[model samples]
Target: MSQSEQPWWRGAVLYQIYPRSYLDTNGDGIGDLSGITRKLDYIASLGVDGIWISPFFASPMKDFGYDVSDYCAVDPVFGTLEDFDQLLDRAHGYGLKVIIDQVYAHTSDAHAWFEESRQSRDNPRADWYVWQDPKADGTPPNNWQAVFGGAAWTWDARRQQYFMHNFLPEQPQLNVHNPEVQDALLATARFWLDRGVDGFRLDAINFAMHDRAFRDNPPWDPAGRTITRPFDLQRRVYNQSQPEVPEFLERVRRLTDEYGDRYTVAEVASDDPLPTMRAYTKGDERLTAAYSFDFLYASTLTAGRVRRSQGNWIGPLEEGWPSWEFSNHDAPRCVSRWYDGPDRPRFAKLMNALLLCLRGNPILYQGEELGLTQVDVPFEALQDPEAIANWPRTLGRDGARTPMPWEEAGPNAGFSSGKPWLPVGPDHPGLSVGVQEQDLDSVLNFTRKLLTVRRGSPALKWGELSFLDVPESLLAMTRTCEEESLTCLFNLGAEPVEIPEPVNLGGAVLSQSEGLIDREGRIMPPYAFVILRD
Candidate 1:
């Protein structure tokens, strides 16, 4: 099928499952592959098209499962290789495509590839990782800073040189500049593809390649932006966001294209990622789609931010497609971040409404259907590297990654029979799946209705988005496809505002929350959103 023919992933709602927190079946206090298999039916009932599982590969778990030690096998903590195979089969049986995480950016320090590369400068895999000589003063090769708050280079005694690591020190950066490294990474992708994965979610894809010259990064002025860590003090142009990334993506694309309909969505991290996103997905030969931290880490969700973030890329013809995600394992939940206090329930519903109605493909994180909020993980129990390293400064990801609450009354809310890796919050039990299942008007059911509405409407699934010039506080946009047009308006603030156009939760509406508009035809209360079809 052509790009315009609407492939399976085009505008698809992909549900992101963080396996370590999804469920625990083996009584190990950790979520495993079998637990995910058990919940396949519940996930399918959410009306999402596919499930994008986070890293479950064999890893040291330094950064959780992202630090891959073996690309082909599943980690013991998650489950065995057989468990993953069964999980894949069960997901496909539920009509859900399985997209596994492919970490091309780096490998664990314990990985065999890294072990050999670190042993000697002339080993078979010696040049597989980025290595450089230290300065005369015994300092790092350059001034490039790591994402987790330290110098980007770490000393390796065996190789007698420093190796680059964009994140944690345990996660050494791969030398993708080497053809051998690229080939090996591609082979890993092929391995998973051969194992029945529909596609791959390239983790930290922009970090796949870097300037090989060991160039120093320029400093950035903190006048207009908030600098959370020392890593944020530099422009990071030379350390990452290399021009060679797109070419590497094409190689990956050409490889996946051989598999017929295998999609790739790059996770871009940059100061200005919209342009990078456009460049990365400029053609079909590149990534199938790309998403950045536009709305994910934004302090406030405004109409202008939404418009610029969504409109930066031209139509799908000029630029490749874009994927939008409000909350993921990396960032805090939307209800806690975007939904202003007062009407929490209404706000959660409104947030989901806007997310599903966006122009790009929507990525809904697990437990978002139950209106899950961020849990306040104490500093003592912190797990993320960046979070632990920059505590009090960083709002660690542990809050968003806590175990998925299944029952309101069961032990640890039915997430595990034993104590979970992360403690369950007091507020999560009331928002558990079991609790939401009994309430017909719960956000869980409302999300199901919204998704059902989305699937049936061509205007929503494949439509061009144009922002309507209303108040800045109100996000008004129209999705048009031929004769069918759907107008979405949301009051993302506390003050009530007059409706730009007369709309109701009646006929013209596909789905909406009731009793929000005042008698004078004004959208009232915080977080009021409505959809009108014409």
Candidate 2:
């Protein structure tokens, strides 16, 4: 693809910033917009095209910023609207695009729309939220379960009906089936677009619409699953992934198109997100792209797993672009989750190289560049309701959402003057940004090199991807474009492996390493990776 014809978002690298844990200003012990603005240069140094700021909208913090109370206002804890404007301006000056989280699936129960909808039955917004009457036995309208736990339907004395909430009762599902509701959502999108946001990372978009009939979801066999909550007991057929979701996305596309060059990506969560992802992004009239929990929740990352995901969309003319992320605010750090012991550091760099080498847009979590490991938050220190509800079995998200370490040692590891909302682990001080920023051999530098290499190569940016049929534990893929053809390989294991003769590693090691290739065969260390030109 040529420069003129290339879409800004195609094969882009998005760095996700969980605003609450990124950095803190004003000694609030929590990260805020000003803190983000203070670190804009640090993020720009990472060579990412954009920053995806997780919800900073007004909220009660029931599910962090995911439960938005006001769509247009920035939460006081994050900063005022003026603060956001300053951040946006500073980011643009650094040639960075700003993408924000848009929680369209639901809203904080305290939202005026939901508040008014819960009043009288004849109100103008009475049907704005999903409200239903209880069954004959006064039980919930259906067997659908909330993602955080308990029944999806919450009993509300107001209007004498039960309101539906897919995650927490504090976040009631919006009745997107209503035309007025869709119009209101579009208005919110417009509010952000007009405020200078480049685009949005739609959170749980598959849950944006629900079955109009409010039908009971069927139970699924939990034979091989680790069922943590009641939600895992049923196949989420009726509650979400509705067929009408694509039509709604088309409307969103139209709204964004009017604003010019706006990008959209859907976060589809399900056992099988391929169908929804494919359908939602099947055409330009719908979403520009969509990503699921393919690598986020996986027990392992193997050759087959990578191949299957990349194979889902193949060649230069594939229907839609793909996006990938190894870890985020919601899941355990990939290095800690996939490997441990002395090999952890090696595995970290290996995975970073592998993720960047793949055929899709990549999302880098805030602390990931520094190879920050997950910090375990004790039961008493836990802030995530999902973790508090499920405890040890779930391995809660609190560990992953710990504050980013910016200094080797100080109050909150230089993250703040006050104590952080989440603990700054003892292990993180050494891996802090200040400590690694100057070290050429640090994971931070290595990751930056990988991103530099990716950005400089057209084949890596916009190329046709095809997996090589190779030996076990050895994953290899070829990326070809009009200008160049490249091969990428990885040793996703704990032991050394011998590379065969035909596995040609022509020249250069983007990731610094010793003894990468030999005449006999390249002896790969555990978690070793390399990129070569054809």
Candidate 3:
């Protein structure tokens, strides 16, 4: 199918499920593929168009499932290959497209390719991974730093040389510069395509290629110079985002094209993402869509910030599509990050409207529909290695990975009768899906209503966006198409903000926690949003 004909990803709502923490079926305390197959109906009930399941491939679990030991096989912890087939069958039966995570940039050191590459310098697979020579002073070949901290190069005594790893030491970077390596990775993707996956969420795609010249990177010295994590210390110029990275992406796009309607969303993270996104998805032959961490790490969600961020990539959006996500497995949950007042419910509803109203594919993280708050996990209860290494300074991601709460009164919130790998928070029971499903004003119900609104309007899905006169804490915009035109307004602050008479609607289409009825035509209630249509 041609780009114009593909509708699977356009305006799609993707619900991300972290398979390890989603549900546990057996007494093993970990979520498996079988557990996910059983929950397909629950996920479908969210009104999302598709699902993006995190890595469940064979791995040693060093960095969870990101370190793939075998790209084609399912881990016993997740289930066998047959169990995955059953999952694809069931997800399709519910009319939900399934997109799985593809970690092609690197593989676990335990992988056969890496093992053979490290065995000797002249081996057939020696060039499979990035091998570097040390400088005369016995330093690393380049100044690149690992994302998990320390130098990016690790010395291997067997080969009498150093190899590069952008993430954990156990996860070695593949030399995507090699045509054979690229072909092998493409083959792995083809294996999954044949197995019936709709598409892929490419993990850390920018890290696939590195600077061939092995040049040192310039140092990054911010004014505050405070180090949140070791990875933030230096500017990652040579370590990733090579000019040749897009060529490989184009090749992957061609491979996906062979399997009609199979889309690819490159997960891009860099010191600068606007130009990188433009370069990666600049033409018709590259990835179908891509996403970056612009809003995921923001300290505030003000209207001005949102406009500026959106404005950065809107120009190059014609080159390819853009995917927007407020929260995911790697970042803190949106509800907890954006909340500051007593009216968290109102805050969640407002934010939900803001997210879905944006002009891109909006990815809703699991448990988000239930208004789940971030869990306060004690140091002893922490399971994330990154958190354990850098305690008290960095807030670990464990708080966001807690098991889903399905019932209000059952043990483990009905996630599992067995002990969960990650402890469920005591406060989660009240926010369980079972309890919220019946409530008319619950977050889940509001999510359904919002999705229904989104589905009913093409302007919210594929219309052109134009920003209006937005005040300090107010956001107003218009989305228009050939058939319909609509205006959206939101007051993001705690105090009510006034606006001029909106474009059309006699009254507000959707209001916030408080109503807006006034003689002056000003909207009432802080953090309230409304849609006006002609």
Error of 2 at 173 (Å): 0.6
For the record, the alpha-carbon RMSD of candidate 1 to the native fold, in angstroms, is: 1.9
> For model 1, where is the 10-residue window of minimal lDDT?
498-507
Report, for every candidate in turn, its global Cα lDDT versus the true structure.
Answer: 0.86, 0.87, 0.83
State in Å the error of residue 321, model 1: 0.9
Model 3 weakest 10-residue run by lDDT = 510-519
Listed per candidate, the RMSD to the true structure in angstroms reads 1.9, 1.3, 2.1
The candidate 2 region of ten consecutive residues with least summed lDDT is 510-519
RMSD of 2: 1.3
Q: Which regions of candidate 3 are displaced past 4 Å?
A: 1-6, 313-317, 502-514, 517-520
Q: lDDT (0-100) at residue 349 of candidate 3? A: 82
Error of 1 at 497 (Å): 0.9
Candidate 1: misplaced stretches above 4 Å?
Answer: 1-4, 501-507, 516-525
Residue pairs in clash, model 1? none
